[model samples]
Target: MATVENRQVVLERYIEGVPKVTDMAMKIGKIELKAPKGSGAFLVKNLYLSCDPYMRGRMRDFHGSYIPPFVPSQPIEGFGVGKVLDSDNPDFKPGDFISGITGWEEYSLIHNTSQLRKIQPDDAIPLSYHLGLLGMPGFTAYVGFYEICSPKKGEYVFVSAASGAVGQLVGQLAKLHGCYAVGSAGSRQKVDLLKNKLGFDEAFNYKEEADLDAALKRYFPEGIDIYFDNVGGEILDAALLNMRIHGRIAVCGMVSLHSISDPKGIHNLYCVVPKRIKMQGFLQSDYLDKFPEFLEHVTKNFKEGKIVYIEDMNDGLESGPAAFVGLFSGQNIGKQVICVARD
Candidate 1:
């Protein structure tokens, strides 16, 4: 193994409101890309990087998040697809494709080779898909729908942020399970893509509807049996009022509450008593044991045209900051990815 030098994107400081360019910075440095002698670690050449809303939680100076905040003046890390450049581990080899936790840099020395799975490139799915459709967001959709929602055939399923990475797949999965599915998104284009392109039974632009509760009542006049919630706050409050008996609600992420001072309060909790609704918050990590089962189900659906995926990719690592900040503004149409090195 040889020493290697690489350039990386590092978080410069903790941010408030929307993050500016100064919040993160880039640096070039020298280091051994290869693991230490006899360390059994592998070095990876970074490729596609996922820019997700959840990363915002990691940027704040808080201890309540699932993960710790990024240290100042260091490279921020998250899920990324990469190819192995050097290896001292038995399970991984040079040139093997993988996707897992890595830094926003050109190269990373990933220890604990057991944590990185070798991706079969011949599967014909995009390697980038590992970050979205066939990855965390995909698993989030699967667990939330089948396990949390406990959906039944012919039931009505309502999804908020329906055109997003997780929401799109959840709606499609609900359809496959014989449920009537509808999605609400922020833009008209997303609404069209949901109903006309993604096979959602119905779709609406939440921005266009001044009254969310009124809008939900119109779409689910029969009442909602399953609510796959991605954006909480007033939306959650609205959905609570329209739930059917023994309804299920999976709280995946609360993107709406992330940037605000005081989050919207829910006032319709009384409906839960009469409906006996099951509302549970979940993290994708909680269902890692079901990864193989989820992969099989989602891959079959993808090949059969029962599921479709969308990605909004920017060209370089330098664009990572803006691409991430855009999630709050509804700028990305689908999963947001940043391409640092394609080959």
Candidate 2:
């Protein structure tokens, strides 16, 4: 077996509030390019890594989350697309591409292949899309919009964090379902992308809106049939106020509260009863049984030009920390993916 130097993004310490690049340090370690005999593990070279908002929860010392916290001084784990190099597992073999939870490093010895999917390479779809458009974020948007939102044709839908990884697809899926889709993003650029590139019916810069309630009213005067709440805070309150009768709210993310120590409460709880809105929070992990169906739907639509996905890629393993921290500040335009290595 050959020994190789592996460069990894290691967490220096568990964090509080907003994350900083200094909290994670890049370190070099050596690994044998082989999976141990009878270990049921496969060694892989990570190609692309996903930087998602949920990773912030792992940076804290909380164990109550759906996922476990990152162990400090180790390479923090996330979703990645990798190429198998050596395998002690019969299901995976050398030269196969797989996507699942892997370390933020050059090479990973993946132990649990239970959730991992073997990718049959398609030239029409980029391999990196496995971490974004065809992966967890895409699946989140699918399950949330179709299953949670329970959307109907001609319904009015509003998506917060609109141009983000999950929200972008939500808005598009709503449009495809014959609904009026609107999205709210932080910047004018993201707003433009939402409306023009992603085909949302309308988009607004949330930062420019002084009153979110008024903003929602303006966009959804008849009231929103579905509200994809990505940034919970004032936006959620506003959505609550504007929800039509029997409307549904898919609570996707809380990027707004990651940096806040003292977060404010939503003031529109009473509206839920009066409006009869169905609001639910979900984890993509919960709906693992539906992954194959989701993949088939997305891939077929994507191949037929009925669906499109956008990604904001940062190159190299060394850039992982900065790319991750940038999520809090909304620096990346779309799905933030770190290209650790390219085949």
Candidate 3:
């Protein structure tokens, strides 16, 4: 097969503070469509790319994190949904759709297939969902709420960044488990969705609150039994003060602090000691064994209309940079994804 041009979203340089679309450049590159013999790799035509809050951590020059920093002048890598075009592995075939770590480009020559999952296309489930609802974000929510928070029936649950990919599901799960669920979002539109669409017991616009602690108190008059912290800092500090005795807190991503070079600490953390709050920070990768269970559970509830997922999609790979940058500012309504190509 003749080599073809692959348009890639490459990191222009290592950046500090909030990321801008300018930090990445769209460069046209070339690749062979065929996977080399005995290489055990597959070649895929990228379809959808995920723009997650966690990717912000990879834009730096740090090396200590679980995932390495994105190489400057190279394609920014993230979870993607793709169709297999060529393969040298027995598990995958030429027509199989896959979801895993893929380059943010038109096509990818994937050598590492460790995290890859063979996607069986369904007319009911949108292909892009593998990058969001059934993807890392959704899995993260399951692990955090069920494993980390250890939620219970009749508990008072709160989720910050409530309209985001992970938070939206966390709030819904809390409600489904017979808990009083409240969520805080950045805008009124999102807050409305939390109440009217996502089925949260109550939703608030955190940006409109004069005092976050007071806002949480208004919503959770009995104190919170579980607090799923997605965006850290101020909201976390507020939730700390509102936690009930023996409450549990799941420290998910600190999307609020990701852009900060020197982030401020929560002053109310001392409340954790007095409240006996079980606070834990976690990564979804820690619970890979539960993936089959997670998939089965979410898929069933989703199909029955007991659960719903929301997404904000950007068409074309050229829109990748702006779509990613939009995540930090609450510009996206739900799961932010870039549609690279249509299958």
Candidate 4:
């Protein structure tokens, strides 16, 4: 068999307000498909890469973000699961499955083998689940809900962008915990996905609602105790006014604010002080030490058929750029995955 060279998706420029196709470029490049001897590195055949809203932040030149911006003309990387083609690293061997930060390319020479996790085959979940339900987004939802929000049974919980990757899981987790969960999305079909498929108690289409505050009030008649915020700007402002005393807010991502400069500011700052509401922003990496516990919890729910997940897939590495841009526009029905090269 002929040795395969990698095809990588590279960032062409740092985005300003919103990303465009012109900011990214995918092209072929040469890479060793096999791991070199005694290098403590492994070679992986990239199968799936997650498309996340947080990646949009990395596209811009931002200070105080979780990581530095993706340099121009460099291969973009994100969470992915891959099959080991060869391993000079003792922890992983050829044919082993793994997940972590991998390049948006056909293959990768991963030097920091310790950073990559070896996916256990004994676990009855699909390997791809490691990138979504069993991965960062899932952990984000779990930690945000349990640690950040700290809900009581029968308390009202609200999730914005609830049909998207992290939002869907947050709604389901809240339901599992006995909280009344409501979600908002951009489309009627997504609202259906939340209420019908994901088991959210109620869902509203933001596009159809003339007033976001009225919509939140209508659903959360008693005021919300916990709010898992995914879309910020106006939604956050609306949620702030509707929060109960001692309410908690977990700031996940702000997809609504990502596309615009001078985003709509919240006018209800007084509510936070009087209500004693706690609002916090968290990164998934901050909870990395708890991943094993999260995997155990989310996996059990999956096995017991207590959870439902949906994915919108785009085929091939070439489609990656457009698929990522679609996240900001709420084009994806569920979690977005770019199928770089199928195993």
User: In model 1, what are the clashing residue pairs, if there are any?
Assistant: none
List lDDT for all candidates, in order: 0.86, 0.91, 0.92, 0.86
Instruction: Point out where model 2 deviates above 4 Å.
Output: 255-262
The TM-score of candidate 3 is 0.98
Model 3 Cα RMSD, 1 decimal: 1.1
Q: Which lDDT tens digits does candidate 1 get at residues 147-196? A: 88888999999999999989999999998999999999999999999988
From the highest TM-score down, the ranking of the candidates is: 3, 2, 4, 1
Model 3: how far residue 331 lies from native, Å: 0.2
| Cα-based TM-score, every candidate | 0.95, 0.98, 0.98, 0.95
Residue-level lDDT of model 4, residues 1-343, one tens digit each, is 2377789999998888777777899888888677778788889999999888778777887767657788878889789989999888888888998988898999998997545788876556766777888878888898898888888999999999998889999999999999999999999999988889999999999999999899998999999999999977888899999999999999988643555823556688789999999999887777778888888888889899999888898899899999988887889999899887767
For candidate 3, give the lDDT of residue 188. Answer: 93
Better of 1 and 3 by TM-score: 3
Please rank every candidate by lDDT, starting with the best.
Answer: 3, 2, 1, 4
